[model samples]
Target: MDRRRVIIDTDTAGDDTQALVLAALSDRIEVEGLTIVAGNVEFDHEVENAKYTLGLAGKADEVPVHEGIRSPLQKEYETAEYVHGEGGLGGELFPDTGIESADAHAVDYIVETARENPGEVTLVCIGPLTNVAMACKREPDLDELLDEVWVMGGNVNCLGNVTPAAEYNFWVDPDAANVVLRELSTTIVDWGVTVRDSTFGPDTLGRIEDAAEDSEFAAFYDTITQQVRAFNREEMGEDATTQPDSLVVACLIEPDLIEESGEYHVDVDEREGMTRGYTLVDETGVLDEPANARVVESIDAEGFRRLFLDAVIHGDPERSLA
Candidate 1:
């Protein structure tokens, strides 16, 4: 089987780390690079988190990381520090990988990569859409050039996370979300599906803890998830670890994980209001517009948990739990 060439545009926070590790260790994916954008945390911290996470997957020296935009396309910068913590890693301290980001800007790298390998590269965007929108603007045919674009954002005809009507990623940069939704052949792994399928409680955490006894990757994962798990339990009234980014990556790696999906005309609300960044998913075709996105409505919950655990426990050869 030919490995899918992938470029992950991420904010590199807690769950973003899980996504990166999964991608880097996957046999079916050849990660082309990681492009860092501003989101969950500070720009520099996010870049560092990417390098560190790649190191955990034994790809620190191999996969190049490129720094992207520092803020949203047309909004003031916002962060979910309350959810992700100040350092974006649950305040856990790990040894630095001493890896540095590639000198190229993320927008330039994105455009150049797509231009160099048309219809082969898949972009898994797990953050704000600023970098992707700019790349589209820079290369007008980028959407056509890419093999696929999978995004982990939007509420998609459901309630949101950051606000009553918007998910955090889309809320941070609605303009960019609007642009990419309109331009790209995108697939959304939205917030509702994540809350329904990807949230894991103590049983799953116990499994990770068991794996952590032998696997450093699992240990690192357990350590970093401490804060988010607490936040989810205390604040969200959910006793589970939410890893939406990892769920989206799993869907891309194993398509069968998606039990239900549909093509929809999706758009983001850029206007300032309670509905700002709200994802209007045209499920009933009321607007009579062409569908722009394949929205993932549901996924196999047990399959996702297994896939994530398999990666965390035995993905890296040197750090395998067994």
Candidate 2:
């Protein structure tokens, strides 16, 4: 099988770091580049954090990290420092490496790369949809050129993380999210409910820690473990953090892991109200145009976790977390 070429748009939050590690380790998914957007942290901070996380995963030299939009299209950039901590990973620190720049702006790179390889590049976005939205505006035909876009956002029939009707990523940039959900051919991962159902409880964290003792991903695993614990205790008052973005990576590597997906017309509410940034899914199937996305409602949690663990621990010797 041919390797899947992908460009990841992220903010390098704790969970985003896990997804990045998994992608770097996967032999089946070739990460063409990384675009740092402002969501989990400030724009500059996220860029630096992305670089640091890549360095920690031993992929700094291989991946080109780009600075994306600093704020949303029509709203101020919101951050979740309370949940992700100051540095977006519970204050986890990595060695200082020289600041490497992206070869081009994220929007330009997305358009150019996708156009160059029509139907061969997949854009995996795990943060606010700012950069991808900009790309759509710049190229307008990007949706037709790419293979597919996998997004870890929105809530179809479940409670949201930021507000009762909004997930954090969508809440931060509803306008941008709206653009991608409506204009782009997307595969939506309803993390709101799926993540809660596929929780990485204490047992999973313990298993990872125990495995790390003998694996090459020890330091990276240890850092992720600490952040997971902190997110659990500080945010959920629980014992583990739900590996949401890691699940997104799993969807890319093992699409069959999620057996059920429904066609839906998703709309994001951008108006200021109790329902701001809420993703409204038309489950009644009353739309006219071709459904732009397949919203994931369920997942095989064990299969996904195993895939993630294997990817992080054994997939790539050069980028091992040991």
Candidate 3:
């Protein structure tokens, strides 16, 4: 099978790092490059996290990292350091991999790459949609150039992560999210999926801890996930930590993992109030609008954990984590 061509756009915090590791190590996807955006933490730190993540898969020199928008398109930048910690990797420090970002601006790189590979590239956006919206505005035909865009943001029918009415990525830059969702053929793997399906609790955590003893990658995963696990348990009242980004990536790598999905007219609310950045998914067809995106509502949680462990521990997805 032809490996899916992908470009990961990330904010590069704890779970974001896990997502990158999944994309980089899996033989099922060809990571064209990584575009860093402003969200999870400081912009520079996010860029560094991307480099460090690539280094884990021994793809440091092969995959190019490009720095994108430093702030939201129309709002001041916001971060999730409270959840991710100061270093963006649970404050863990490591020796430099000597990996540097490409000199190209992320917007330019995104536009050029799509133009060069029309109908072939897929952008897996796991952060705020600033770079993507800007690129679409720059090249109006961008929607037609790329094959697909997979986004890890928003919420379908439930509560959100960042706010009671909105998810973090869409909340950070509602303007950008609106632009991209309106203009692109997109698939949304929302916060609902993370909360409802792919959460890793104590049992799975113990499995990873056991795998860490024999796999350096699993050790890295175990180390970085500590902070988020605590926050999830204490703040969200959930004993499990959610990896939204990695779950979205897994759906792309293995489509069978998606247990349920639907096509809907999905848009983010940009108005100020209690509902700012709230994803207005027309799940009931109240809008009578044509569906513009596919919304993934659920996935096989067990399969996701298996896929994640297989890749992180064995560096391949063919092996069974169970």
Candidate 4:
């Protein structure tokens, strides 16, 4: 099987860290590079956090991390420190390994990488869409090179996490999100209803940790569990946490785990005050044009968890957590 080449644009939140781990450990996905944006934390912190995360995943040398935009094109960046904590990894600290940084700008990196592997690169964005949008603006021909863009933003049929109508990723940078949703030919894993319906709670986390105990990926899984527990205690006031990015990662590694509906014309609300960054879908079938994106509506939770565990374990039944 030909592995899918991918470039991840993220903010290194706890959830984003989990997604990185999944991508690094998966054989089906070849991570071309990582671009850090300003969301979940500041741009510098996000870049450092991406390095730390890839180091933790034991792929720091294989992936080049680049720092992208410091703020949105229009609105000021807002972070969910309450959920991701001060350090953006649930306050967990790791020693800096001083990895070499990317020499080129993130936009340039995205364009160059896509140009090198035309129609084979998949842009998996799990945070604010600033970098991808800016890259598209800088290189208008990127649309022809990209095979697909899997974005983890927008709320199609569910309530928003930031505002009553907007999801956190889009709400942080509505202008950037709007640019990507409108200009790029991509697929959006809608947060509105898809995420809420496909949650990985305590049972799944415990299974993952248990499975990790016998694999070389044990340490990675353990670290992720600790962060998840902290996030749960701080945000949900419980010992179990539900990870959103984990779901996105699962979708990437195993697209069959997610059941999708028909394609739809999705738009982001950029108006000020109310409904900013909300993803409004034309569900009535009144639009004359064809749908630009294949929107994911639901996922098979059990299958997704199994794939996640398999990716972590990688058939090493004797993997030791220690």
- Ten-residue segment with the worst summed lDDT in candidate 2? 313-322
Model 4 over residues 81-100: C-alpha lDDT tens digits? 66666677666665666887
RMSD to the true structure for each prediction, in A, is: 2.4, 3.0, 1.6, 3.6
Local accuracy of candidate 2 as per-residue lDDT tens digits, 66-92 = 887888888875687767777776766
Candidate 3 is scored at a TM of 0.97
Tens-digit lDDT track for model 3 on 236-305?
Answer: 7876778899998888888999989999998889987789889999989999999999999879988888
TM-score of each: 0.96, 0.92, 0.97, 0.89
Report the C-alpha lDDT of model 1 over 1-322, residue by residue, as the tens digit: 6888999999989899999988888877899999999899888888888988888788998899999999887788578777777778887655677887799999999999999999999999999999999999999999889999999999976788889899999999999998898789999999999989998888999899899989988998888988888888897786678889999888877888899999989988899888889999999999999999999998999888888888888774223221
lDDT for each candidate structure: 0.89, 0.79, 0.88, 0.76
Over 4 Å off, model 1: 316-322
Q: In model 3, which range of ten residues has the least summed lDDT?
A: 313-322
How many clashes would you count in candidate 1? 0
Pitting candidate 1 against candidate 2, the one with the higher TM-score is 1
Ten-residue stretch with the least lDDT total in model 1: 313-322
Query: What is the Cα-based TM-score of model 2?
Result: 0.92
Ranking by TM-score: 3, 1, 2, 4
